[model samples]
Target: MSLFAGMAMDEESVKAGKLQIANYKLGENVHLFGGAFYLCYQKGLINWLTDWNPDVLIMEANPRYIATPSAVKWMHARGRKVIGWGLGAPPSNSPHFLQKWGKRQRGVFLSQFDALISYSQRGADEYAALGFPREKIFVAHNSVAPAPTFQVSRPKFHEKPSIIFVGRLQARKRVNWLIRACAEMGSKPRLVIVGDGPEREKLELLANEIYPATEFVGAKHGAELTPYFAEADLFVLPGTGGLAVQEAMAHGLPVIVAKGDGTQDDLVRAGNGWQIPPEDYGALVQVTREALSDASRVGRMGEESLRIVTEEINIEKMVASFVRALNSLRY
Candidate 1:
């Protein structure tokens, strides 16, 4: 099977897997009215498709892209199986027109695919609700490569708790909510922010004024991130994007994530962590205080988080699911 990716995939991923990938050179990344879209152009796509003649073609299902629809129809006409892979359906909070017309258009477009691969079960359900067949939709939980091995010594309840937030500091991320929530925790726990973006300077200013215990670590990757994950007693992302949630869980830290994008539904479970309503600063503060106040529960929850990442959602497991989906198409 061959996969067509709009962005550059890791060399290790291509070498380790049986599936071959063809990367496209992206053109302008148009952003309009708070929505970001990409334009992908592959000059050799048609020739490559003809020469390679892949049994199955898997493409991203982003509505913003123009190529996907045409490519899907082109592949379908040639009797090749096409799979739509992405976070299906826009979030419910999207513009009403998008929810109405956009969803209907997506539903029609997705129904043409032989199968659909969702980032989470919530996404699969959304696709089904939008008229895609339930049986044809597969849940391939989004994940990252396994986190580095680290030993976390459980802290006593009375010990000062360390809370970590890892992601780009952007407006939509609502890092300010986390800063405000941490300040409300009465400076008992140390709050570490481990990423930088447009909101960095402002967030730093807010942290200094409101939460003096907050530490801004700019951005760290690979082994550099190990110490933050290893030392933290709890992980919190009060906004969207929970890829870091899985990474924290893999490092044996329980997460407190906001409900957004439906990706967190698969990763954050009852035993593992809490999922508060989006943008609820009061609830975030209360949850953080309670979780930090009881270290024993946090430790147990951390163990559940570790178990879920190791057993259910990791890079290996995700790739295996993709392989299975591709294999199913052949038979």
Candidate 2:
């Protein structure tokens, strides 16, 4: 399989794996709203498709990409299929008029695809709400990596529960909220903040002042990150973006993820962990304290997290879902 991606925005940076695949870097990204809303149209997309001549084309389901409609048209003209894959429906973060315009444009763009794939069921429902055929929408449950093969075992309890947050330290991540909650906890847990971003300096300042015990480990990944997950008693994401939730679960760590993207609706279920309102500080502290209160309960919850990653969610399952959706389109 081949992929077309652009390396324009800082957020677009990716970790290249060992797998060999045709990866075309196309487009000059134009960042607006400080990289929040940007557009990257692959000017050579049509020529690339003509040369590669794939039977099916899977692409981001975003209206911002001006070349996508043309690509969809080119694929359809050859009796080939195309799939629109993305987080979900058009974001309503803009003004009312712009939101309506964006939604309408997205509806038209998605209507051309043979099938649609969302990262979560909530996303699928959002697509359906936008007048897309619900039956053609599939959920891949966005996965970060494979389930862990090694056993993730921990003592019945630590003298102090180690709470971990693994992701970029950005304002939206709300790592500050996590630090605040950890500081307010009656039984002060060892809060470990992993990953770095523009918000790192400010977050470190806050951590030092209130939660002096908070550990800022900068950024760790792959093998370097495994130990933190293995050693931690609980994983918490106080902000948005849940790609780290499954990773935490794979390591058998129960998660406390604030509901951000709809993806959390499927991953963080009842038995495994708790999902709180994105900005509810009181709920964050309360649920976290509860999760760490009973040692046996935390252990059972961790087991459930492992089970979810093993059976229900993972990169393997996500790929299977994509295959099922794509194969169905072929027939």
Candidate 3:
């Protein structure tokens, strides 16, 4: 069972086999006493497991949620295979005490599972480093569906360049860094900001003050996001979570992203995109300048990006990898 039953399932996944999804009635997440708390009813859990009679169970490895651990133990007791999927590494530069404690706790908790699936190769390596058996660790790289094809021709370098950012406008996203970097450019590109959050007004105010060419297009999805990808010369996400990086590359746009979560390590490469040190404004600015300096280089990098997504990291490959991992546990 999964927490996000309404999540979009690709046609490839549907055709792979019969699939069932379930969701917990998520309760309000409260933060107090220096920790987070939330509620999930276990009322129907036993019944659901009984009815489904699943051969394997996959769950997120967030230890904060008591329900997951309880469910894991329940399923294991019944002789069913259980898998914990997660970002295997702690947050970069996490507190020493928290890191040490978390490592110990996760080692104990995750050891109960039949196998552990990491979101990236880096994550799998981390699981191994923590003493999890290497053979039991699997990498099912995160991916997104390819964007709809846009018929537009590539923009020339001298033509007005478009630099786009697509994600939640939150503090951790550090979108303000993109705005500040745009301000430093000699020839400013048209900056398109997609998705909205609490930081919208603040970001809008900063954009108006320094980078007037900035356009805030609000949140977009599916085909609605195609044009932004089609019109852009480059894509930038100065914070974490890079599912958008894969989508942009599928649309033939090269990327610039911050280094943090290992997601970028799997998606971004030398020819396809560049990874900036997290929160390093100077390095961000310098890389942006050099990348935009040559228009032809941008076009070439975009081609490379498309090739990588099409051949190496598209949803088809991701689904195939998942199917192989799941089948391996069946026997």
Candidate that would win on TM-score: 2
lDDT of 2 by residue, 61-119 (tens): 88778788899999989999999998887377989998899788778877888899999
Q: Candidate 2: list runs displaced more than 4 Å.
A: 11-19, 32-40, 90-105
Worst window of 10 by summed lDDT in candidate 3: 6-15
**lDDT value for model 1:** 0.78
Q: How do the residues 1-331 of candidate 1 rate in per-residue lDDT, one tens digit apiece?
A: 3433433333212222233454433333233343344444544456557666776788777666656667777798888898889886855566898678767787777777888899988889889999888878888888877633555555543257788999877777788998888777764688899997778999988988988779998888767898888778899999876568888898888999999878888889889999999868888889888887777888899988988888888888788878878877887
Highest lDDT scorer = 2
lDDT of 3 by residue, 1-331 (tens): 5342222223212112233664443223332243234333334555566666677887776565456777787788888888888878554356899778878887887787778888888988888887889888888778868433544457655377789999877877889999999999988888999988778999999999999889999999878998888889999988876578888888888899999768678878899889999869899899999988988888898888888887777777777766776777877
Q: What C-alpha RMSD separates each model from the true structure?
A: 4.8, 2.6, 5.5
Q: Order of all candidates by lDDT, from best down to worst?
A: 2, 1, 3
- Residue 306, candidate 1: C-alpha displacement in angstroms: 0.5
- Model 1, runs deviating above 4 Å: 1-53, 90-104, 147-153
**Per-candidate clash tally:** 0, 0, 0
TM-score of each: 0.84, 0.90, 0.84
Q: Which ten-residue region of model 1 has the weakest summed lDDT?
A: 8-17
The global Cα lDDT (0 to 1) of model 2 is 0.85
- TM-score-wise, the better of 2 and 3 is 2
1 or 2, greater by TM-score? 2
Clashing pairs for model 3 are: none
